[model samples]
Target: MMVAIAQERDRAAFARLFAHFAPKLKAYGMRAGADPHTAEEIAQEAMVAVWRKAASFNPAKASVSTWLFTIVRNKRIDMLRREGRPDLREEDFLHLEQPVETQDETYEANETGAVLADRIAGLPDDQALVIKKAFYEDKSHRAIAEELGLPLGTVKSRIRLALTRLKTTLPDS
Candidate 1:
């Protein structure tokens, strides 16, 4: 009957196949934990797959029942996977807002930054360079050592001395 449907587009063959397998497929879905509506949907989709894939079926591989059951199982898995995903909606995005700083906060931040830069400038050249690379340029101490061709210990010492001097001079935040 599958071969007949594949070769001739036989509606009678398909009707017989659907009639025999639809209820069984639906029951299989329910036994596997689907609700009645979902089971019915799975059965209908599986039968549609059978009709579309009839040309690809091989009797040597498995019987028709095995093939139909496999299609139904796959369709059930696909449905479950789709159901597990969260649906996106415009309302879900409406609550998120980008932070905006007020004018006083922005001025305070700029003033603090300027004070920090002035304190760093007061350090000796080597200590100031290390501090700038480590904090302003965002380089690691080891990377600063490599770039400056200084020993790792020398780079670390420079950063420590710079921080100690700045701490003594700067007011507590």
Candidate 2:
């Protein structure tokens, strides 16, 4: 019934499709290391693709679940590729600006640092340590693990889990 309605480009069919798969797709994104907001966006994008491509769906060739999962997987891969590519704007030196060293600026900078430090301290010790090593020390997970005498998998898992927890705990933008 849904397949026939979707084949005919019914709006209700699309809505039903989104209701059924969006949560599942978002879960998939979360498992793939994406934050909840990003996961929701990816799921919506995948559903839109499903709506647009419904005419091409062949139930005999593949189930709707398989098609939806494939779309979500491809979207995630595309997002990762986009993130791995350096931003051209950042690469261009024209956008760079020198900071003004006024008294107010110095005070603001110190306050910002204090706030950041407090936030980091509030996190679990393991998470704080991993984040510090990755960002402050600019070290790779493998290097950090070796330096700490920890297994590489343990380090990676800790970081991933920390990020997931942070995603939920941090205030939404």
Candidate 3:
């Protein structure tokens, strides 16, 4: 009955559909290794898609549960692909002109750098040192190792772990 109404774009049916399946979608995301917050966001997005696409749903070909889970699964795959892709490139900067350094812009840039430094400081001592050597000092991993009296592999791993932790902590730029 709800599915029929949803097929007709009934708002109440859509609300009922969301109420029933949103939690299951979130649980599915959690089981797929997303954090709880991320799971909730994924679930909400999936349900919103369901509402928008309900008119196309074919009950003869698939159960509502199967259709809904398929949406969640597809969204998760898309998220993984996006995560695997490198969205930013250093070479992309070559095409852009430098910003005029207004007083406000300069102040904001300094403040942002200070905040980033503080965040880097909050990392484990080894991680912080590796980040500083590699990024702040603009040294290559091999050069960082030679400077720090550490093996190249160790420096590489430390920098990688530091970057992962930093990504988890930082707001999206």
Candidate 2's displacement at residue 40, Å, is: 0.6
Best candidate (score: lDDT): 1
TM-score of 1: 0.47
Q: Model 1, which residues run further than 4 Å from truth?
A: 83-173
lDDT tens digits, residue span 103-141, model 3: 332244345546766788899999998886654333678
Model 1, span 58-163: residue lDDT tens: 5444446546656775677678555543433211132213232233322443465577778887889999988866643436799999999999998888888888
Q: Could you tell me the C-alpha RMSD of candidate 3 in Å?
A: 19.8
Error of 3 at 14 (Å): 1.5
Please give, for residues 55-160, the per-residue lDDT of candidate 2 as tens digits: 6655444435545656776677677445553333211122213322233322443454465567677788988899777753436799999999999899998899
Residue pairs of candidate 3 with colliding backbone atoms: none
How far off is residue 8 in model 2, in Å?
Answer: 2.0
Which lDDT value does model 1 have at 19? 76
Candidate lDDT (C-alpha), each: 0.69, 0.64, 0.64
